[model samples]
Target: MRKKIVAGNWKMNLSLEEAQSLHSEINDALETSEFNCEVYHFVPSIYLSTLLESDQKVNVGSQNGYPAKNGAFTGEVSMSQLSGIGTKAVLIGHSERRQLFNESDILLKEKVDAALEEDLKVFFCCGETLEERESGQYKQTVIKQLKNSLFHLPSKEFAKIVIAYEPIWAIGTGKTASPEQANEMHKSIREAIEHAYTQEIAQNTSILYGGSCKPSNATELLNQSDIDGGLIGGASLKSEDFLKIIATYN
Candidate 1:
């Protein structure tokens, strides 16, 4: 089965104390609940070690890491560093990281290469802005982004990655894609993978919808044919909403 997964991207929002509290709450819920989907919680880099020290029932990953394994780069965490700290995954090419830090596709591809070399699973993100969508370029835009950064990997390496389709416009605007819209994009992504690798790979890969996902809309959104799960943003900060979303999928 394609493992249905929900990953919470805690984006620069929690302190060490807050991280511990939220992690505890989430782990408690996961431990007590009977759900089949994998739950991965990603936190800011600074708290990775602190998050790992706890006995976590759910998976924990870093939000980002430097492309290099190790170097003279001061102030940047490398994939090796992440592995040493027990982080099993990393988010590559998140829209915020692309826009705010000017991370080009080339740069992100480098990050993906480095992370995979260290055997870290990747949550690779791709989507279009409102303008691109309005201009009818969203489909091609997303495909091109995938090709540039991800299609280069061999099927084995690609199999270890999760694709997150987060419509940039809907991400924090409280707007969401109708189920049809989300499924449409997800189908396109799956087709792209099929074109790059094989039909089996496309069918088995998990594609997550990540724009403003909440419990109220998650069911309808996830009910679509191709969307495997969610990459939750704000709702993930609250254990109740996040667990509710999982229960819906359950």
Candidate 2:
């Protein structure tokens, strides 16, 4: 069976103290619960070590990392550096990185290669913008992202990667793809993976929905056949809301 996961992307938000307190609150709530899916906290780089220092229930990962092991690249953290500090995973090609920071697919592929080399699990995010969606080219756009950045990897290496589909228009806009729409895109993504690799590999890969996925809509979205879990945004910042989404998997 595929791995079920709900990862929280605390994208560039919260101060160090706020980060710690929020994580602690999540941990405290989960202490007595038995969740069916794996949980991950993808926080800002500045707070990674402080959160990882403790033996917590949920895994911690970086929101971004440089492709190089180490270099004079100021303002960038390397995959090796992250691994050395016990960081288990990293997010590659998030829409914000692509649009806001101007990270191209070529650069994202290098980051995927570097992260996998260091044995860091990669949450490779890909999505379509409002224009692409409205143009009926959303599938083409997203598949192109996978083909350019992630499909090059051999199945063995690619098997370790988790795919998150975040509709760019939905992110941070208080908009969400309807459950049917989200699942349709997810199914397209899985079909693309199947064509790239093998049927078995595609079946085993976990594809997550990331948008305005809050407690209210999580169950409906997650219950869709192709959506394995979620990459939560705003809901994750609140422990109660995040926990409720996790409970939906049960």
Candidate 3:
């Protein structure tokens, strides 16, 4: 069976001290609970070392990374730097990055290649804008993004990758895709994988929902056959709510 994964994306939030405190709370909660699902926390670069030292089951990850291994790129974190600090995964091509930094598919693909080359897992994100979704171009947009950003990689190299579908309209908007809606998009993305690789690879790959996922709706969302788990945003910051979401798998 594909393992369920709940990844907390603490995007552009929390200071070093606050991150340490939050990590303490999360670790304590995980220890007391019976949650067996794979858990990851994508914190800002500064807290990676501190987060890695925790004795919790939560894997360490970064919100972003530079496409180059190392260079004179000021303010850019490289894959080598991330791996050296014990990061297990990196978030790539998030909607906010696309909007704020104007990252292109080519840049994202390079980042994916760089991360995989350094043996770091990747949570590659893709989604459509509100206008595209309303115009019924959601599937097309997702397919194109997948094709451009990831499909070029060899199947063997694909094993370290996780795809997150975060509908732009729903992200941080307090709007969520219904379970059926989430399942439909997830199934379609899986089918796209099947077409690109094989059914076995498609079934084995973990696909997550990432749009305003919270305790109130996490169980319903995760219950869908194709919906493996979540890429939690705001809800992940709170220890109690995050643990409640993790309990949905238990």
TM-score of 3: 0.98
Q: Model 1: C-alpha RMSD to truth?
A: 0.8
| Residues 88-120 of candidate 2: C-alpha lDDT, one tens digit per residue | 999999999999899999999999999999999
Candidate 1's error at 1, in angstroms? 1.7
- The C-alpha TM-scores of every prediction are 0.98, 0.99, 0.98
Query: Over 4 Å off in model 2, which ranges?
Result: none
In model 3, state the lDDT of residue 8. 94
Backbone clash pairs in model 3 (N, Cα, C under 3 Å; residues 3+ apart or in different chains), count: 0
lDDT score at residue 119, model 1, on the 0-100 scale: 91
lDDT per residue for candidate 1 within 1-250, as digits (tens), equals: 7889999999989888888899999898888878878999999988888888878787999999998777899999999999888899999999999999999999999999999999999999999999999999999999999999999999999999999999999988999999999999999999999999999999999999999999999999987999999999999999999998988767
C-alpha lDDT of all candidate models, in order: 0.93, 0.95, 0.92
Clashing pairs in 2: none
| Backbone clashes under 3 angstroms, per model | 0, 0, 0
lDDT of 3 by residue, 99-183 (tens): 8899999999999999999999999999999999999999999999999999999999986789999999999999999999989
Cα deviation of 5 in candidate 2 (Å)? 0.8
Instruction: Tell me, by lDDT, which candidate is best.
Output: 2
* Model 1, residue pairs in steric clash: none
Please give the lDDT score at residue 51 for candidate 2: 100
Q: Is candidate 2 or candidate 3 better by lDDT?
A: 2
